[model samples]
Target chain A: MSEAIQPRMIDFKPHEIPLEDFDISQRELWSEDLKMAYFERLREEAPVHYCKDSEFGPYWSVTRYADIMEVDSNWQDFSSEPAITIIDPEEDFPLPMFIAMDPPKHDDQRKTVQGSVAPANLKNLESTIRGRVQTVLDELPVGEEFDWVDRVSIELTTQMLATLFDFPFEDRRKLTRWSDVATGGPETGVVETEEQRREELMECLAYFTRLWQERQEQGLSNDFISMLAHGEATKDMSPEEYLGNLILLIVGGNDTTRNSMTGGVLALNENPGEYAKLRNNPGVIPNMVSEIIRWQTPLAHMRRIANRDYELGGQTIKQGDKVIMWYLSGNRDERAIENPNEFIIDRKRARQHLSFGFGPHRCMGNRLAELQLRILWEEIQKRFHMVEVVGEVERVPSNFVHGYTKMPVVLHPL
Target chain B: MPKITYIEHNGTQHEVDAEVGVSVMQAAIDNLVPGIDADCGGECSCATCHVMVKEDWVAKTGSPEEGEESMLDLNPERQGNSRLSCQITVTEELDGLIVDLPEFQF
Candidate 1:
């Protein structure tokens, strides 16, 4: 971690902070869920705002919905290479995942593995997902408070990740640990040091490397490892490349819907009217799923590098400057979404939201994520009157993963 | 007004009066047709609005532009006749056009 001094973003109100000092990258703001007001101010004042200095150094923030659409879609001007988060990826230990690579290279590698999670395969996986969801939900004790984030959210998504990888069912939690460790570091408490973070990631690479070797001997298969091992394009991927892609897949498949699962329960409990809307008409589950994903906006922002100087929102982003497209902020931008702050389940054009990001590099596992959430909610509706939020909910103390660490909830059976 | 028929994968046909110059996607959303998610709200960037034009209507609808083709390239289920409904503008030439909605969007 950079030894740069921490900015006490929470001490200053959103409006009180000077525009130049508006560093939304601060962990305190996201941990406390205090970043929204700051983003609202930025979208209102400076849609293409820049912070001259921060712990991660200087960068620009694109907060408006349409501006994000422009930056995200134009990978030509806004490069995704190097990294896709606010902090620059660790040097010396580079992870060359496709999400961070530009076109041609990005498209080639993503094409090889995207098939495993695309709509065609998702159709086959639906029954398996629903069955696991049933088992996970059925196993939970009703009327007793439990950590929904762990018991339901983590378990369900983790199981889905395992199924997608055809990973060892007994050792599935390792996937969760690796996913957490990949995105987190000493500050978030996943690992005590940056060196340890890299060590665990290498361990992740070794394990997957073994899986790759084991699966390479077998015939072509449906799981990600088998597909990659057998894929014409990915067969000879470097260890770093394999690990980078694995982290991308594991975290991509795990954290997103995991947070959405917990977020939906809290969203419903917070907005009882929406819960009632759900109970009255279960048919709205699909639409509600989109709304929930939008509401959570799980991965808060995607970072990009300006390939060339470009003008957006009347501000000129110079080439080589790091840029952060705040999807969380864009989702709440009033200009695009109607009544952006409210959680309306039946909201029209819910899928048009920025949570998926737009353009070629848009999320590869979006369909799987949606299917998982939709089925999970469908199962929840049939089993319980409410997954009531019964205790203090702890938010993840990081900007990238907008999620809950612990959400105490007690299911009231119908 | 052009009568564009959106045939779902299951053979359910929804024939709606598509307004002149309106995209085929907007007509379905207006008519509350079951298929065609149109997630990007008429931007050809998202391939979710994919639809297969019938052989008879292919000439009238035309081929996808570079942007549309690039997006469709990412979709595994994309067929030779696949065109994003959001990119297909409803016009007099397409009066009797019929397109088949795929089983699911990418």
Candidate 2:
């Protein structure tokens, strides 16, 4: 609320806008929830549309399901280095995390910590996650309106993140604050200035460094700090690199799931049929989790730099062009998904969506995310008849982190 | 049509007839077999369609190529006989093929 985003689009329908004038990367469109119409137009007319100018500069939008798959899977052709968002990496304060790095290094670093959050490992954490979900649900006031985003979504995700990192239980909100600062710039009001953002992040690194040293002195444990401290590939990382990976894990585990949590409740309220379907058959929660992920599309787009001149969707993209794979757009592609806009609780092949991206860079926490959501919904169904939305839902004003800011809700018992 | 037997983790076996050219992943999906989730469709990009060929039938299924190997390598559950079903095309040579589905798809 520090400053209003500069208005870029006039009151014209997305279809009325000239194809050349489409630059869907603007933050205003995301906050206003008007980016979908723009993406719909791009998918129909120009699956691989290029915007000559945008707030983030020139970039090409891969708006189709098949085309996004091609770009995301072909890492040799389109690299993730330098940056993974439309905004270029800060030159002075470069964060060399593996998500933005290409193979060999990316593979090695990812594998070292990957074991902790892998699906096999998640089975052991299921009870712990379920207990936390139950605790959160049990504490909420029945029939009383409250901010669901803060009470349930943020509370549950932050608690789970704390358990994963072995972070301090009382100071868990710091993880939420840090996740926001890492992805958001001063423009979004996470901090007053660029320097303040860096300073807070440094404080985060210093805090984690203490835990890393403590873990290094002990036997290898199951927590993330212990895994990183003992991991051969990650043990030698520099301070900046460690901070980069920390930010990556925090944001990856936090904002994405938090949004989906609120998004699912909102979606269920909006579509009563689906909510009824969920009530009748609680077994559909697992499938509904995938559908919710697709519907939310927590991260709207992942940017890549073309490594060589490649022809995609009948357009020649230069070697140095910035390419954005709009996962939100692809998840709604009618060509790939049947009735892409509707939220069907029992949609077949629900997991086949670009929300996680694909190939090596596909989300490492996909299973962990699913497990949490499954447990939450399963527990929610057992207790509440309906978690009714009571008022206006506010959304986060960033195209990169597609999520909610507030959703007021009240729980009703069966 | 070649006959493919997909054994789920819980010992449930689904024997389905497959077309001559579709993938083993497609066969399971088409037959409504429960375990395999070919998230990438028939593309070798996503290793979600992971399956372990029964020891007796491993040779007939053939080894995974380099691209397929890279995808399978990303999975922590990958075993020595592990393969991406999407990479395995159905054929007469794959008749009576038996593949064991993992407990979970990565």
Candidate 3:
């Protein structure tokens, strides 16, 4: 057994560490050396460390699983208003959705959008979504290498989301780019020029505006956008508000699911025994889906505002203070998950992951996300004998979203 | 058996026999209604069981409790007649109660 390292104070002021020192654009979230170092540090001192200065601002980072659950569940104390990401919007472009709002009004806006993506609606999409996944996989280049992130993961998820909104098929990739710009700006790669980012945002809004107008002119249909366009939520949704909700759904549904697919395949490649176990017992796909979500935890963290002064983990949190719940860390909490680090498919409590988040603001598209993942695995198993990671797996630089930017895999078809 | 009617978001109505003493949410789940998930198992924690009480059946269902009221504050389509299905217990008087499913419940 490794000895537990003693707790020591380490200041994580953002400004103290220059942005250039951290390769935010690199595919590996942390260089392998850094990842191991940080995980070790988290297991020891300051599981709930405070950073004095970050690019966004000073905030508390809740790294433990139990601590994240406590904060996520207790929304009365830790509100979802002001902002939901660690980087303050003023310092960066703001996320326009009301996922950041608090009670009363938050409830109203949520109700409007919830009508379209509820579980029942998701169930109806199962076969359609599954078929779409199969179709995407069926077209893959048999023995050749390709950027799985772009060709498979992004294409499949973006198409599914576009189908959900009844968007034109040819323009679906735009949805992917917009979401990339919206969430990818703060983390790494080409920092989108302010004008380029603005253009993308406007493009997204204009697309939704046109859709809303068409729906209004015609009538409500089966699509989510139509449902939102004519439903109770729209009674008060201004053009901008409608566009904001559309963007929220697109982002919520896109990266998280795409990453899980990429992550699940990558995890299987890394653990061949587990992959063989899955191939032998196809019955374990459902459980395996949950495990992948837990292991990958595509969305790393979500921020909440303290409604009032409260105390947690022996520290006092003033009202309106920012609290960052690291869901990735929470999903691997040693207290909540057994053998937290290992990728165990049959672990009974695997579904109890913070990846979908918890409480009211939990993911709206969780069921759809899971369905897509399960189908992807099922199709992959039927068509391919093996998936080998031919090269290094790249991770997005931003702390908010976690997943590969480029995962080159060579598919071996049976 | 009490007859209850559920009008889905698309205006499709499902009429079924509901047992007395079970909440509307339980009735929907018992009948395998498509939209009512009740993911939190009727704890009023997840707003998945949200239903709109028909105007005529308001008195039979009674007003939402303080907790239900607060919980409803988190729902997106909350209306004047919005009630959490878990909070309402079935009674013979509510045999013909009508409830409408919202278009979305995440």
How would you encode candidate 1's per-residue C-alpha lDDT over A111-221 as one tens digit per residue? 888898888888889999999999999999999988998998899889888988999899999999999999888888778788898888888888888889999999988
Docking class of 3: incorrect
| Per-candidate RMSD, Å | 1.6, 1.5, 8.1
The predicted structure with the larger lDDT, 1 or 3, is 1
Ranking by TM-score: 2, 1, 3
What does the interface RMSD come to for each candidate? 0.9, 1.0, 4.3
Docking level of model 2: medium
Candidate 3 residue lDDT tens string, B1-106: 8888999999999998989888889999898776776754565555668899999999888998765676677554578999888788888888888999887665
Clashes of 2: 0
DockQ (C-alpha) of model 1? 0.74
Per-residue alpha-carbon lDDT of candidate 2 for residues A67-93, written as tens digits (9 for 90 to 100): 999999999999999779889988999
Clashing residue pairs for model 2: none
Query: Candidate 3 chain A: worst 10 consecutive residues by lDDT?
Result: A1-10
Q: Please rank every candidate by DockQ, starting with the best.
A: 1, 2, 3
Per-residue lDDT for A63 in model 3?
A: 77
